[model samples]
Target: MKSKPVLTILHRLAILAYVVFALFPLFWLLKVSVTPNDLLYSEGVRMWPSRTSFDHYAFVIAHSAFPTFFKNSLIVAGSTAVTVTILASLAGYALSRFNFKAKYWIVALMLITQMFPLVMLVAPIFKMLSPLGLTNSLTGLVIVYTAFNVPFATFLMQSFFDGIPKDLEEAAMIDGATQFVAFRQIILPLTLPGIAATLGFVFTAAWSELLFALMLISGNDSSTFPVGLLTFVSKFSVDFGQMMAAGVLALIPACLFFLLIQRYLVQGLTAGAVKG
Candidate 1:
């Protein structure tokens, strides 16, 4: 057998290697964001340019319509995350706790929705929403995103509910609390990690969604970050510096979001262990 110290070193090395692999793109993004346009190509493949400036970032912030795009994205992503979480929680809890007829078919149907390519569905979705006056609106984007995300989010929460024993809620009910009350106060707290995870997943999905945003939204006023990123691309040339700067700025909210709820995620795997 491998020695403990050798095994530990190998494990740590593997993690370090993976971290570097994953973070290298982000590092390059930030690096290029700060790199001067004049030196962008001249610097070649050097790890860092001889010097850097905030010109691209300054221009993108002060001059571009990115603010509008950022606002729309925040509203859409936040709304979608909250809406999907609430609906998914109720649906997942139902699927986990209740054994009504058609439960098997309901789950199978949900699974089937995930099997189709989103590309094939976007046109139909656009056509359906366009007549309802939902197209090009943030609310419409949220509705579309929520519809796409709820199924997976429901399955995710259902798994979390499965890990939790029914005894906790039963005990609560024995104390005169209704099922909804027990769920709200007791089960919801224990399911924090799942909720946090679902929120993050849905938020990221809505935040980065492009196909639906592209097909539905025609104006810059309602564009999300992913769509706004395309504004930097033109018929003649691409604005790499400003685009990279915008990309770097986009990472902030997601990073802060995870940091805010990271504590809840820490104990997800061990949920209900102490209670049971």
Candidate 2:
């Protein structure tokens, strides 16, 4: 009885500490975004600047190429997430339910793909895409992002599928449902948490991806948010104000995305929480 209260206190403290640690950077980004350019260097890392302004936000929205970049990023990340999730759902179901020839080799190949440094494949990927008129296009980026993310997303989806029982499928079949119908109507709805989790993972990854976007896309017309940040840097100085404002803006869609799916996210992530 005496130890319970103490343990509770410690657990709460630990959670508080973790929350602060995770959100500190976002707070700083918001802080910097509102701080005036003149106060940035003079302020000397103060928690709150003496003065604040939304000038940076205004400039980034109206006077910069950031809106175009934002649009392009939304397109690439959204397309990649949707495509990867659909493919992963089917592949993961097959991997979970069906035992087939070369299954071990297929899984091994996926693991191998993850182990190699992304840098090693950059040159080869660029060479392959360029010949097909894929370079400097959002379509190229989506295809690349989907390819790299499918193996991991499939594995993630498979974990959720494994947790569900096959009895449901058998029962549905007994009721005159076909395999595809059962999967489409029954298993898919039950796997909402998994789909939500996978969408969040793939969306976040593609949204923040810079290297492949940089290598595959060249023109501002095709640039994503991360690559478009380069416009703030010129020969000498970095525009911290507009850059931070843009950074803050970039975080909105991701936050809204998780917000929309957080119901399933929490269920999927914490499903085994109460396990014995």
Candidate 3:
């Protein structure tokens, strides 16, 4: 009994420590965003500042082009997540349910693509897109993000599908349902956690993506939040307060997105536990 209690205490402590470690940066960002610019450096590494103001947030919202960046990022990331999810679902179902001659090769190709550095492909991708007028366009960014995210999303969905019993689909088929219908009505619904996880993963990846956005988008009109953050830096100085405020704003959508999907994730886990 004593050993069990001690082990439980240690486990809880470990989780608490990890949580603090992960959230410390976000806490600091929030702190600096609230801290007055005058007291920022003067505070000398304090947890909280002497004085606080919302001026930085106000400036970022009203004065900067952050709104446009925010909108563009929303459109791009949301579109990419939805598109990847749809494609990955179909592909994952196929991979999980069927055995085809080309399946091995297809998986191999995807793994090979992941092996190459993204940097090496940037030049070729830019060259190809430039002629098509895709440079500096939000559509172009969405296309690139979807393509990049689909492979991983497919693997994620495949793993989820693998966990589900084939008997469920077989039973549905025996009841006069086609494979696609069975997949749609039976298998897909149960993979809500996997879907939510994929959405969150792709959204977060597309949301924070800077390299491609920077290389492809030149104008502020099409820039995403990651690129928009760079506007705060200048040759002479950097606006730390305003930058932190912008970062806080950037985090809001991602936080809300996960919160919305968390229920489905929990439900999926519960279902899996009960099934097991």
Worst 10 residues of 1 by lDDT: 267-276
Model 1, runs deviating above 4 Å: 1-3, 268-276
Descending-lDDT candidate ranking: 2, 1, 3
lDDT tens digits by residue: candidate 2, 138-249: 9999999999999999999999888778877888999999999999987898899999999999999999999999999988999999999988898899998899999999
lDDT of all predictions = 0.93, 0.93, 0.92
Alpha-carbon RMSD, candidate 3 = 1.7
lDDT of 1: 0.93
Relative to the true structure, candidate 2 reaches a TM of 0.95
